[model samples]
Target chain A: MPYVNIKVTREGVTREQKAALIAGVTELLLQVLGKSPALTHVVIEEVELDNWGLGGLSVTAFREQNR
Target chain B: MPYVNIKVTREGVTREQKAALIAGVTELLLQVLGKSPALTHVVIEEVELDNWGLGGLSVTAFREQNR
Candidate 1:
């Protein structure tokens, strides 16, 4: 079984995008490892920028400083 | 801020598995890194065995008991 958990900063990702991501991951797993799509599981998590951090700074602050 | 995402091949994991994993991970982060449980997010994704692989063999085929 292939389980994939994708974490991304939440920024209004559409349902279609989520579906495409799941499908793409499934197809890629199948092609690369001969896995079955029916047995693949893909989960997407949308995290607030404030909840994500890099180098001890929240993603919110990181983006602000970068800009 | 700490966000934890766990992916596991699904095989009828119990409710205890969900609770224990989330709680344990949360506690670990708190103890090790001083992350607040309130700010921590834990998500678990379960994949089917047929989709998982090792050394180019699907877990389904890899398991002799499955045959």
Candidate 2:
């Protein structure tokens, strides 16, 4: 069983985009790893800017400092 | 760096439950693998019943069939 988790900043991603991402990732795994689509699970997670961290700082704070 | 993702069907999971899961997982990794807490990332994903599939049927359909 192959389970894939995709994490991104919670930036207004539409349901259509999420569906496409799931389908695309599933297909890629099937093509590359010969995984069965039935056994593949794809999950997308959108994190709030304040919750996601990078370089010891939250994404929101990092962006503020960088910008 | 460790990235852990936990997914379950979108039942009514309270914020406290999610927080407990994240904390419990992160602590487990740190204790078992000696991973750094700062470098550990835990994400919880709640999936809709219709989106999750099992045995060639969506979870919704599978539940209905079983019930």
Candidate 3:
């Protein structure tokens, strides 16, 4: 099975919001990517503040570094 | 940008073979998943014997455990 797992920080999202986002992502993938819902696997890992990064910089540190 | 990175063992594969496999995988994803080659990203990481697992067991350990 080809599974797509997305790991992102959940700083501002609640569980319900996360679920809705996942559902939307799954729907988009199915419609745009043509993947069957049964065969497609989507896993979301919500990382804490200290564990997320972007452009080779941790989110918090990057914000601090920029400030 | 959504990228699909596949990490697998390179125990029995040559460099050329690995490239071929990646190309084949990308093609399959494009045809079967209907993902555009431009937006789709694929990365392959080759793991050594000590760093791989399957069915809750290390590959070598699993083979040994089965014996």
Name the top lDDT candidate: 2
Which of candidates 1 and 2 is the stronger one according to lDDT? 2
Which residue runs does candidate 2 get wrong by more than 4 Å?
Answer: B1-6, B12-45, B48-67
CAPRI category for model 3: incorrect
Show model 1 residue runs off by greater than 4 Å. B1-66
- Return the interface RMSD of model 3: 9.7
Sort by TM-score, best first: 2, 1, 3
TM-score of chain A of each: 0.94, 0.90, 0.64
Residues B1-67, candidate 2: write the lDDT tens digits. Answer: 9999788989999999998998998899999999998999998878876555444345665578899
TM-score of 1: 0.54
Prediction 3 global C-alpha lDDT? 0.54
Residue-level lDDT for A52 in candidate 1: 78
Candidate 2 vs. true structure, TM-score:
0.57
Error of 3 at B2 (Å): 9.8
| Steric collisions counted per model | 4, 0, 0
